[model samples]
Target: MLHHRPAHTPVRPTPRRARTALVLAVAAAVAGLAACQAASSPPATTSVTPAKAPADRPDRGARDGEAAGHVPDGATVFDDALPALAHLDPALLAALQAAASDAERDGVTFFVNSAWRSAAYQDQLLREAVAQYGSAAEAARWVASADTSSHVTGDAVDLQQTGGSQWVADHGAAYGLCLVYANEPWHVELRPDAVDEGCPEPYADPSQDPRLQE
Candidate 1:
């Protein structure tokens, strides 16, 4: 006898299950699109602050000199901006200015190399001279003590040698300006008597000056 076989039947999904499957597929596609957009996007930027610049400081040598009443190079007697020229004794300044004006007619210019100085600056110069000369006596020949220095008192001025000293040497007596030191030809002081009489003989050096001796 032959045996009989049962036929296979196809199974269909329920409506609820079909709906859940469709929703899962749509959710997966949305998640993939979001990931792709994130990957293509630019990176976030961070803000940074710039560093500050350093403060400016003046040259030590120049600052020190300026503070000590040292005038700039090529300074003239008419430079009222500089204390070295402006602080000079009134009588001395007037004589120098008058002589300088007349000197211009002769093609000579008066340049003041050194003039009024702070007492501290004078003391510093004396100390430096002593160190350079190796003795107080040798230094005294060039630099005087602050107490006795005419520069500190604003009664003396040192002129540039180029045209100033020679012109002053020739015409200074007429204006009451006279050289006070034989060694320092550029140094001048006002002596009213020099206008009528003449400049007295200069001391050989500061060392021989009677005023410095005191």
Candidate 2:
């Protein structure tokens, strides 16, 4: 008798489960897009760079001289205090040795009286000269202009030949040394070949602080 009842199977939507799954999938997709958008945004980065400082010079004389109105650069500070033959370039030293030997052979003994002077010492000399002379004008007569002065630059040397000034004047050519200034009898400079092309020529007058070239 109960079998006469129509067969009833529960009808539900598998499509409802699909609809719920689709909504969850779309939500996940939106979340994934938000994550990607966050990741793609540019981040700020800080970059640090260091600054460079001016070069330092160890030569006290050079530093003080510059402050006190002298013109020698820091690059030349180390060079200003080297001993003769000791400070000279090796090849130049060899040439000097050969020339000295030649001078000896010719019965002239070439001696180094002085070479290499610090700018401070040079300043001291100038000051002392001024004190003694009583004015810059008078001091200028006794002392040399700092720029053209060989004593200030290591390149200039004081030489005393065994024979005499005349002997050196006659024979110094072989050594490639010359007397550049009439006032300095004991002074001799390297020949043109040995001389640095960078060496400043008769420098500017001290009364006017014109730019000097190397």
Candidate 3:
């Protein structure tokens, strides 16, 4: 009975087995911590502000039912009229500025009411004119039609002469600009060749050009 059980050394756990068990437990604990961290973490992101538009972007359109100026670059408000300043061709613009400067020197009076416009802006104006006049045909007679719009080219300017349209008509050509349509003396273009090209001048009729279909 009280004979010490077979004089046994304390039954030792095998060192290798103990080490294996320790390694397994440590791995399991590490895995559990990783899961907890993942669960508590928030999405790895931050607030984003809208990017500003570029300086070269179109920046001109209509204002208060009247032609306006060139638009500044970086504008994205397509639905609304772009600010004046967007539609100037640099070569013609410089020439125009020089001419205007000379006129200023000479005390010649001219007022700029409009400049370059995006195609969409021109389209909008046509629509509004149609709405106001109550028919597409009537609107065409009253305002610039969409397809032949010189405004879309950024080479056109709607001007108000200080003296009269005739004054502007007389002086505008010295700057390589001419009235595109005889009807709208205010609508001017930079290209004189358009007259020689027999390009079906928008002055008499502004129906859509069949060539534009190509």
Q: Model 1: residues >4 Å from true position, as ranges?
A: 1-64
Q: Model 3, clash count? A: 10
**Mind giving the per-residue lDDT tens digits that candidate 3 earns over 20-134?**
9999999999999999999999978988999998987654433432344344333321212344443466665665665566676666644566666666667778899899989
Order the candidate numbers by lDDT, best to worst.
1, 3, 2
| Per-prediction TM-score | 0.73, 0.45, 0.50
**lDDT per model, in order?**
0.90, 0.55, 0.59
User: How does model 3 fare in lDDT?
Assistant: 0.59
RMSD of each: 7.8, 14.2, 12.2
List clashing residue pairs in candidate 1. none
Question: What TM-score, to 2 decimals, does candidate 3 have?
Answer: 0.50
Lowest summed-lDDT stretch of 10 residues in model 2?
71-80
For residues 100-161, write the lDDT of model 1, one tens digit per residue: 99999988888988999999999999999999999999999999999999999999999999
lDDT of 2: 0.55
Clashing pairs in 3: 59-71, 60-71, 69-84, 69-85, 70-84, 70-85, 70-86, 71-85, 71-86, 87-116
